[model samples]
Target: MKKVLFASTALIATAGVAAAEVNFSGYGRFGIGYVEDRSETTIVRGPGADGLNGTADDVLARSTAQTDDVILVSRFRLNIDGIAETDGGVRFEGRVRLQADEDASNGEANSAGLNGARFSVIYGGLRVDAGNVAGSFDNLANYYGNEVGLELFAGQYSGVDYNFLAYSSTGSGANAVFFQYSVGDFSFGASYDQAQATVIGAGGTTSTTVDADRWDISATYTFNNITAAVAYGQTDAGVAGVSDPSLTVLTLGGEWGDFSGTLFVADDATQVASTDGTAWGLSAAYNLGAATTLLFTYGDGNASADTQQVAIGAIYDLGGGASLRGGIGRNDCDSCASDTIVADFGAQFNF
Candidate 1:
């Protein structure tokens, strides 16, 4: 009986090893900041905030700051991904993420959050991806520099920083269907999504509902170091009081020796009451050496309360998946305060 049990355990272990595969890769960034002028009327809020009533003063007055200098942390994330294969050319992949300073505050570190997961199958001339992931219509545009700039035209408002028509909210995990056809450097694809919005509020309370349906199509052409693409997207909101929004974007991106840049423009078909706006952004990065790089960006929006920003930054790789980054940015707004400055420095590590 003991020999039979041992043989069964050995067989199971061998099968497990044979059926499993492992790959690990992730990136992390962390830093400290000091904003000379944090006196803005417009406030930044969490993704769950109700309206645009929150202000920078609300956050700064509550958080601890030192004299004219305040400690700030921004955009830190750690992610791990895993994949396992099954029968019939089918595969499953999952990812988990930890965000420390998503709020750009110096407070306690936030916990690990689920980024996304997906299941896929492939055959000749056809591929299907169904699960929770970034949508097809999402714009891959950089609206600002590495550290302190904001995405003015990312959403309907100057302060809103997401291209919702292009990207679905991932609170409850949206369902996405994607189809693609490829031949050489020319390819085309389309995606459709129908997902329920994540619900907040306990007991009886008023909550903002985001039941959005979206569709997107894209085509790309590539030659040498230059790649250009055009994409169109639209979203229909089922919830009342929210306007259905549609957007069209054109992007041109390329990489040359030691230099890379992306230029993007997006026009919003339906704008919010106070913010009907079109947005444009330009971002470029240049490598100075094996250890140093430079980045610059500019973004502007056409809201009645127009906003614009400029940023410049430098990063130095320190080996061992660690680096140093710093930047300065200036923001000017018509509705909010006229001008503000942001400065930050930080070190990052990954394993």
Candidate 2:
């Protein structure tokens, strides 16, 4: 009887240790909205796509159209993390992620399935990370569910929607590496990436070529409630006949009490044909209360034609890891016959 009790206690202790070694957490946002102008010609389809035409008055007049404005959903995510005991004391590590949207939307396609797997190894004063993940370099900021400044560097600055150009390496493709070091309230880092592009043009023209080599470096400083940073990046195409683009970006961001905002300016110094332009953007978010927030943004670009955009939105936390969001936006161009107005509302939850 004594032996059995001792064994049972040992098993319970082992189980508790195992549980304590693992960590889990996640967050997500869902949103929907109604646009007054759903006419194909009045909307900007995606980044780099041509725009549709509808009078600004006509678009704004229909703000109450009341359509299913579900813009973003399935924002749920999960994470599993743990640290391993190694020879150098104890190393710290973790992995967290979610499936890409294309993978979750279609049941028949597994080609775009897994998003990424990230791992980190830390020892002494050095840490190394390897994996498929998303990160922001420099002081350039990311606009959640909106647009990112890096897209302009890739020659994709159309004033339609939030779709911007992105570079990714997955499967048997290229990879990225990042390095960082910190002292006091200042930190600096740099990242490099290389990948291949599988381009399938219209009329059955499919081509596979080495994409581009990209590098970026940035520095940040913090003082009281303000933090500021700047970053520069360059991309060189490995294939002949493709344009090699180099980009420079400056970003300033800060937060105080209920206010947070980022201002960004970027220039594309690509010497290659069909890939040179300049762009800038500003975005701000303010907390209204514990459960509510407001967002505003403005952006412009000098590619193809001069284009500009403005947007405003709000989010309300609904408790239980859920929130309600809605926003209205407009896109205008110098030579276009019409403007676009976009509005949407939706709910997001996390578990």
TM-score of each candidate?
0.70, 0.65
Q: Write the per-residue lDDT of candidate 2 for residues 73-99, one digit (tens) a residue.
A: 334445656656555464656564443
What lDDT tens digits, residue by residue, belong to model 1 across residues 28-59?
Answer: 66566766643323344432333323322223
By summed lDDT, which 10 consecutive residues of candidate 2 come out lowest?
Answer: 148-157
Candidate 2 Cα deviation (angstroms), residue 83: 3.3
**Candidate 2: regions farther than 4 A off:** 1-20, 28-31, 35-73, 85-96, 100-113, 123-126, 135-174, 196-211, 239-243, 270-275, 305-307, 332-338
TM value for model 1: 0.70
Which candidate comes out best when scored by lDDT? 1
